[model samples]
Target: MDEVSPEETPSQKVPPWLFRAILTGAVALGGLYVLGWLIAELKMLIVIVLVSFFLSFALEPAVNRMERLGIRRGVGTGIMFLALLAAVGLFLWAIGTVLADQIGDFADDAPGYINDIEDWLEDTFDIEVDAQGLLDEFQEGGAVANLATRLADNLINLGATVLQVLFQILTIALFTFYLVAEGPKLRRNICSLLPAERQRQVLSIWNLAIDKTGGYIYSRLILAVISFLVHWLVFWLVGAPFPVPMAMWVGLISQFVPVIGTYIAGALPVIIGLLDQPSTGLAMLIAIVVYQQVENYLLQPKVTAHTMEIHVTVAFGSVIVGSLLLGAVGAVLALPAAATIQAFLASYLERHEVVQELEDAEAAQHPEREPLGDRLRQMLDRVFTPK
Candidate 1:
C-alpha cells in the first residue's frame, strides 16, 4: 500500500473509543424501543396490577386493624375480602332491583315523554314533530335505521365489556389479597437485598406511601358518605323516584371518579327527575349546581388538604393527565401516586436556598417618581382648582 498518514488509516478513520461509544448508544436506544413495545403489549396487565395496587392500599387499614386484634395477616386479608365481597353483592343487588323497576317505568312512560317532546318542539319552534313516524322510519331502511343497527351492535358489545370488567375485578382481588397478606414479608425481603442505609430509606418511603394512600382513601370515603347523605335528602325532597339508588350512584361515582365525576353523577338524577316531572329535574339541576359549588369551595379543601398535600388545580390536572395516559384506572390512582411522589421529594430532594436580598421599594429605587394615587390627586386638583 502507498504510504498513508495515521488520519488516513482505516483504524484511525473510526477511532476505537468513538466506535464503541456509538455502539453503546445504539444498543441503549434499541433497548428502549423494545421496552416501549413490551409495555404497550402488556398494557392491560399493567392496568390490572395498578388497580390491584390501589386496592391493596384501600384494604390495608382494615387488614391492619385485624392484625392488631391478633389475627394472622392471611386471615385478616381473608376477612377483609369477605366483607368486601358481601358489600359488593349487596350493592349489585340494590342496583339490579332499582334498574329493573325503573327500566319498566321508563318503557311504560317513554311514549308519553316522546309525545310531550314532540309537542314542545312543535310549539316552541313551530316545526312539525313526529314520535311514531320516527320509529316507523327507523324500522324502515334509512339513516336512522343504520343508527339503530349500530346501537344494537354496541349493546351486544356491552356484555363483553361487562365480562372483562368482572375479570379485572377478580384479578385485582387476588393481587390485593396477596399484597396485603405478604406485604411485611415482601418488605423484609426487599430490605434484606439492600445496604443498611439504603434499606432504612427504602422502608421509610414504603411506609410513607402506604400512610398517604390510606389517608387519602379514608378521607375520600368520608366525603363520599357525606355527599351520599346530603344528595339523598335533596333527591327525596325533590320527589325523585329511585332516590336511594340514585344517591348511592351519585356519591360513589362523584367521589371516586375525578374531574367530570360530578357532572356524570348528576346527569342520571336530573334525567330521572326530568322524565318524572320537568320542575323536579330543574330543581335537581339547581341543587346539584349549588352543592358542587359548596363542595368545591368548602368541603373538598378541608377533607383532603392534609392527605393530598396538592393544590386543587394540580389534583384536577393530574386526573386529566392520568386519564389521557391510562384511562379510568390512571385517574383513580393519580392522587395517591402524586402524594407518594411529593412525599418522596419532600424527604430526599435537595432544598432550595432562601435568598437574603430584600425587595427594593419602588419609591426608593426611583426617588423622583410620585405614587400613582398622589399623581392622580394632583391632576384632579389642577383640573378642579378654584381658578
Candidate 2:
C-alpha cells in the first residue's frame, strides 16, 4: 500500500461538525441520565414539597383574610398552624382512646365472634367446623408466641418509621409556613423577573390556583361537617360506641380521602356494629349506602358545581391516574390539581356559541350525503376557485 500522511488519513477526513454533534449528543444524554437518577433518589423529598405546596395553596385564602384584617402574615400562619395542630391532636386522642378500648373489647370477644361465625357457617352451608380443636392445635404449634416475638422484634423498626414520619411532617410544615407567610413576597419576586404581560399572566394563574385550591378545601370542609352531623346522629341512634369519633372518622375520610376512603371509613363502624349486633351492622350499611346516593346526586353536585367545575368522570379518572403515579398522596391531591388544571385550560380555550336551531335545520335539510365524487368536486371547486 502507498504510504499516507496523517492529514490524508480516512479518520481525519471526518467533518468537524460530526464530531461536535456526537459530543453534544453524548453530553445531553449523560446529563439526562444523571437528572433521572437524581430525581429517583430525591423522590421522597419531591413528594414532601408537593404536599407542602398544596397545603400552602389551601391556606392562602385564610392568610390573606387575616392580612386584610391587619394581622401579620407570620402570626396568621402560626395561628392557623396551632389551630390545625389542636384539631389533629383532638382527632388522634379520640381515635387512640376509642381504638384502645375497642381493641381490648374485640380481643375479649374474639372467641365469641368466632363461635358465632362458625355456627352460622355450619347452619348456612352445612359445613362442619371444629374451631376449638383448630384453636388448640394453633396454640400447641406456638404460632401465636412466634407472632408476638416477631412483633416485638419489629418494634424498633416501627419506632424508626414513626420518627421518619414526624420528620417529614415537620419538613412539610416548615415549607408550608414559608410559602404561606411569604406568599406575596414570593409572587412579587417571581413576577419581577418577567415582562409586564407575562407578570399579569403569572399572577392570574397564581390567583386561579389559589381560588381552586381554597374553594376545594372549603367545599370539602362543608361536606365533611354535614356528613359528620348526619353520621353522628345515626351512630348515636344506633347506640354505637364512640359515636363522635366514629362519625368524625367517617366524615373526614369520606370527604378528604380518595377512592377507597369511603370503604375504609365505613368498614370500621360496620365492623363495630357487627360485633355489637347484626341488626346494627345492617342498619349502618343501609344508612351509609343511602347517604352516599343522596350526596352523589344532591349534595356533591350543588356544592362542587361552582367550585370544582369538573365533571364526575373527569374527577374519577384524575384520581385513578394520580393514585397510579404517586399512590396515596397523589390520590389526595388529585381533585384540587384537576380542578386547577381544568380552570386554567377553560380560561385559555376558545369557545363559540352553539346554534341549535340552525344545526337542526341543516341536518333536516341534508340528512344524507351526496356521492363522494360530487362532494370531492365541490370541495375542489371551493379550494381551487377564486374567493
Candidate 3:
C-alpha cells in the first residue's frame, strides 16, 4: 500500500455541509443532555412554586378581609401569616397531647394486650401467634435498644422530619410572601412577553389555572375536615381506640393521597378495633363501608364538582393514571392535571372559531358520500314518477 500523509486521505477531506451536519448533530445531542438535567431541576422548582402559590391563595381571602377592615397590605399579610403560625402551633400541641396519652395507654397495657391477642387468636382462629418472636426480630442492639428503643428511634426520625419540615416551611413562606407581593407585576410581565393576540389567551389560561388550583385546595381542605369529623365520631360511637388521633391521621394522610383515601382511612381504625375488640371491629367496618357509599354518592360529587367540574369517570381515571406515573405524588397531582387539560380544551373550543369553521367546511366537502342512500332515493323517485 502507498503511504498516505495525514491530510492526503480522501476521507479526511470531508464536504463542508457534511462536516457542519456532524458538528450540528454533536451540539444538538450535548444540548439535549444538558436540557434533561435542567428539566428535572425545573420540575422541583415548579413544585416549590406551586406549594407557595397554594399557600398564598389559601391566605389571600384572609389578607383581603383584613385589608377591607382598613389594614395595609403588608400589615394584613403579616397578621395573616402570624395567625396561620399560631393556628399550626395550637394544632401541633393538641396532637402531641393526644399522642402522648395514646402512647402511655399503649405502653401500660401492651403486655396484657399482647397476651390477650395471642389467646384470642388461638381460641378464635386456632392459630398460635408469637409476640416474642416479633419483638426479638425487631430488637437489634445495646445502647440504641436500652434507651426506650422504639421511643428513641421514633424521636430521631421525628426530629429529622421536623427539621426537614421547618426548612420546607421557611422556603414556602419566603416564596408565598414574594408571590403575594409581586403577583400582579409577575402576571403583567408574563403577559407583556407574549404577542398582543396571545396576551388574552395567556391571561385566560393563567386565571383559569389559579382558579382551579385554589378551588381544588380549598375544596380538598373542606372535604378532609368533613371526613375527619365523620370518621372520628363514627369510631368513637363504635368504641374504637384512639378514635380522634387515628381519625385525624386517616383524614390527613388520605387527603394527601387521592383516590385511595377512603380505603386507607378505613384501614387503621378497623385494624385497631380488630386488635381491641373483634365484634366492635366488624361494626366499625360496616360503618366505614356505609359512610364511604354516602361520601361517594353524595359528598364527593357535591364538593369536587364545585371545584373542578370534571366528570366522575375523568376524575377516577386521572387519579389512576397519576398513581401509575408518580405513585402517591402522581395521584395527588392527577386531578389538577386533568382539570388543566379540561380547561385548555374548553379554552381552545371557545376561542378557535376558525377551527370549527374549518371542520364544518371539511365535513360539508366530504358529505358522507352514501351510494346506497343515493341509489335508494333514485329508485323511489323512478317508482313515483308518472310518465
Question: Can you write out model 1's per-residue Cα lDDT over 148-176, one digit (the tens) per residue?
Answer: 89999999899899999889888888888
Kindly list the per-residue Cα lDDT of model 3 for residues 148-244, writing each as its tens digit. 8789899999999999888877888999987666666777998888898899987787667667766777777777788789888988988887788
TM-scores for every predicted model? 0.80, 0.81, 0.68
The residue pairs that clash in candidate 3, if any, are none
Model 1, position 156, has a per-residue lDDT of: 89
Instruction: Write the candidate numbers in order of decreasing lDDT.
Output: 2, 1, 3
As for TM-score, the candidate ahead, 2 or 3, is 2
Per-residue alpha-carbon lDDT of candidate 2 for residues 1-387, written as tens digits (9 for 90 to 100): 999665686776878699899999999999999999999999899999999989999998999999999999999999999988998898899888888998899899899989999999999999889999998999899998998899988998899999999999999999999999999999999999999999999999889889999999899888889999999999899888788999989998898887787898899888888878899988888888878866776687778877776777988999999889788999989988999889888999998987999989989998977755456557768999997
Lowest lDDT 10-residue stretch of candidate 1: 354-363
In model 1, what are the clashing residue pairs, if there are any?
none
Q: What is candidate 2's CA lDDT for residue 151?
A: 97
| Best candidate according to lDDT | 2
**What value does the lDDT take at residue 214 in candidate 2?**
93
Off by over 4 Å in 2: 1-21, 111-145, 354-387
lDDT of 2 at 269: 86
| Model 2: lDDT of residue 115 | 96
Using TM-score as the measure, name the better of candidate 1 and candidate 3: 1
